[model samples]
Target: MNAGEEPGVVAMDVESTHMPTNSEEFVDAPNFDLETYISRYEGFSKIQRLQYIARRCPRLKNDAYRLAIKDLKEGCNTASYKEIMATVGDSLGPGYGYDAAWCEAEDRKAAAARERLELELNQFKTNLIKESIRMGYHELGRHHAARGDLAAAFKCFVRTRDYCTTGRHSAE
Candidate 1:
């Protein structure tokens, strides 16, 4: 209904609107004010500055985000740590609280990468060792047979048999 239209008379210009049925359709409104916070404690120490940022921006308090910020600052410490800190704070602003989530995700990703690399390395080592054992067995068998010692050749061939077995569950 139009705000000033009569109860019995519908306004031809009034448009009917449907309310949103899902929360996902709603946009999050920006609620944090970074400039005001910076102005309030520009004279504070480094830790104090971080604490204020953490309080003002809940994302900054997240372990991942804080660690990322710290890492970034340390990387630039050789030049000027304070400048790096200021830049990170300015860049993050109200987004600081989610920093920990981002950092945690990154850490998880890195750990997975390292695990994959180690697995590949271990596989490579296993293959190399297996090949070496096979070669050694063949060489020993050939040497014994060349000396006309059939009994010794048979023993060497048997010892080399264990190396051909596959799988981690196979005998060492």
Candidate 2:
């Protein structure tokens, strides 16, 4: 970090996503700009992003489901959600299934959790897009899709598509 040192790269130890608070880092970190990073780094594609999430959330059942669903929606050739869910069930180990009442209750709880997680993910994606777009030039949609933030990603993709079509007509 010393000046006149040719700005040598400093290696910082980023915390691993395996820890419980690792996911929270994505939310709390100010530099977690989905759009900016993706637009800047050509190496981080949609497939790579999904793979990263799969690696990071290996045991987290719902995370895999969410990641797979987002990847499929974003035109990724990833394994289907059912496949991921089956693996998740196996990861959950034996005797994970419950009887009728318990199953119903768990389903309800899962549905609620999914809804909440989707809302939060979309909100984060939206915020990043809005912020990055205001800076102009870079596309904000790709990062959302890459990170499995499907709702916001889809919204941004549609907007980008519409903008392009509108420009084409205006140019004509």
Candidate 3:
């Protein structure tokens, strides 16, 4: 009923004449001051306070909202909204924490880069040994072999092998 009208008369805002059936479905009146509106329900029941904030804020997954629910579940008031926001950076929406496939993809990318680097190193070593023998620097070639140059050590053992291939090296 209206505050000062007749007994059966009901109060209704200009835009919405049909009152909300469910308190959770209630939209805030136009130009409502949110903080003041929440404060008004503090002395009311917990369900009413929760409903008011839930309907008013409309950001259910926010860290501040989650902290408020936690506090409410623990039989305490929200205490401080800013403190709740400070404690949690991002709110986890209704799902598991990390993605296993994403981690695996990142690991595969790193492995591919490492493999490409190793292949390039092997190709460089093969080029160096061929050029050294071609220029007839045999001792310097042996020095390279001692330095763990893979191409010089494994592929350039020409004293043990048959005569060198013509185009590969003229080290006869």
Candidate 4:
């Protein structure tokens, strides 16, 4: 122990204190099939994993971004979509299948879907049918997941547990 230093405390060097903000430097892998690899994941994780790969792997950046954009188009994550588009434009060039009109339309559609699902859930609650309420929450959870609202989806899914009346429902 150094003079006046705590017995258990060890002074950290500058290099040890320096933490990398980004990912470990990626080495391009030969025969790496991005499609087959990405197919292993599902739901929101697929897009996020693809984005992570795109950011880290220089060789696979374009391909990863392309796949991520395609997946994003199917969901309501406009912010991530736009962010990816901007990154692609900055790194490579513009016109990698970005559509502003689609983003706007998707926002509207998602809002409408959320409203409809919430209304249906409210109706199911008023009916006081446990099964219907459970199903309603499940559907709402699915809608929120498709809309990129994971927290709401998780809450809705968790709410289904309260209405579960059978082992099968609990398993589901």
Candidate 5:
């Protein structure tokens, strides 16, 4: 209780509270392995987790970004790749494995694959084959997951349950 203050109130000492601005202050695990750590996650989560780690740990930024770039090459998440590249542009310097040509090529390939899968799914639906329809939905879900579209992947995968013909299909 201080002068002119409420009887039940206490003045707060703002300076006594500590907040860390530097990432180095949070680096407690010096032996952290980014690869092993990221292996537990899949799809979009893997890239997101890596980006989070990169932002929080300056020492691991380069390694995290490098691994993220490698993962991006296998998926159709060009926007993520570009965003990550821009975030680490100054820190990573030039020629840090960013390829515009590869992005364009990968986008084309992904689009073509999506079109083919959708066409197959439509054919299966038209034929009224339960097994084929389920399989078609499963394949489309996988394709969407690989392209980093988690919402679409979840919807496609959920549709498979409606056409599941057996306990095994349901389990899968």
Candidate 6:
């Protein structure tokens, strides 16, 4: 920078969140005394202050602080301050920063569990078909056939055929 150039108007790259100055940047704080609280923890990093406030005064730990602390930590320009504030604030039941990503991850786990259960059920049904046929339980095969499950009856017939040829059950 030139000697006569203004300090505040220094040319910056497109990726700067905070100014390269010693002064702390100011942001709007509604519904709380955020500025004074910031000054109280002026020497602390935004993350540190948030941790302290969350531990000491959870009632006073508002959304604004969470957003600022997250912004300081992540350094991504994806979310507006208010959007971040609402996400950090509105999450309930317990704990901190239960954002969209966390919820989506949980949903994925539940879906996977459901899929596994379905697979286990199908395998159990296949085993039952094989067992009923091997035991000469024609009534169970006839019941399945009456239910319009020809595919299951065919599976049972195939098992019976194999058992007759090999002289051993499919389970063996």
Cα lDDT tens digits, model 6, 21-127, are 66543433345665566655432255456544544555654643554545433432222333444645655334345356644554465456445644654565577
TM-score (all chains, Cα) for each model: 0.24, 0.22, 0.21, 0.80, 0.76, 0.23
Q: Identify the runs in model 1 with alpha carbons over 4 angstroms from their true place.
A: 1-87, 90-98, 129-172
User: Would you give me the overall lDDT of model 3?
Assistant: 0.43
What lDDT is reached at residue 27 by model 2?
25
Q: Among these predicted structures, which one has the highest lDDT?
A: 5
For candidate 2, the lDDT comes to 0.44
Model 1, 50-108: lDDT tens digits are 55455455543443235444543322121223333454564545534224444455456
Per-candidate local distance difference test: 0.47, 0.44, 0.43, 0.86, 0.87, 0.48
| Candidate 4 deviant stretches above 4 angstroms | 1-23, 90-97
Q: For candidate 2, report its TM-score.
A: 0.22
Q: What is the lDDT of residue 44 in candidate 2?
A: 29
Q: Model 5 over residues 1-172: C-alpha lDDT tens digits?
A: 5678988776888999788776444454579988999999876899999988987787898888988888887778887888897787756656575688988998899899999999999999999999999999999999888877789999999999999989999999
Question: Arrange candidates by lDDT, highest first: which order?
Answer: 5, 4, 6, 1, 2, 3
Worst 10 residues of 1 by lDDT: 72-81
Is 3 or 5 the stronger prediction by TM-score? 5
Among these predictions, the greatest TM-score belongs to: 4
Point out the higher-scoring one by TM-score: 3 or 6.
6
Residue 37 error, candidate 3, Å:
36
Clashes of each: 9, 0, 0, 0, 0, 0
TM-score of 5: 0.76
Deviation (Å) of 138 in candidate 5: 0.8
Shift in Å, residue 16, candidate 1: 87
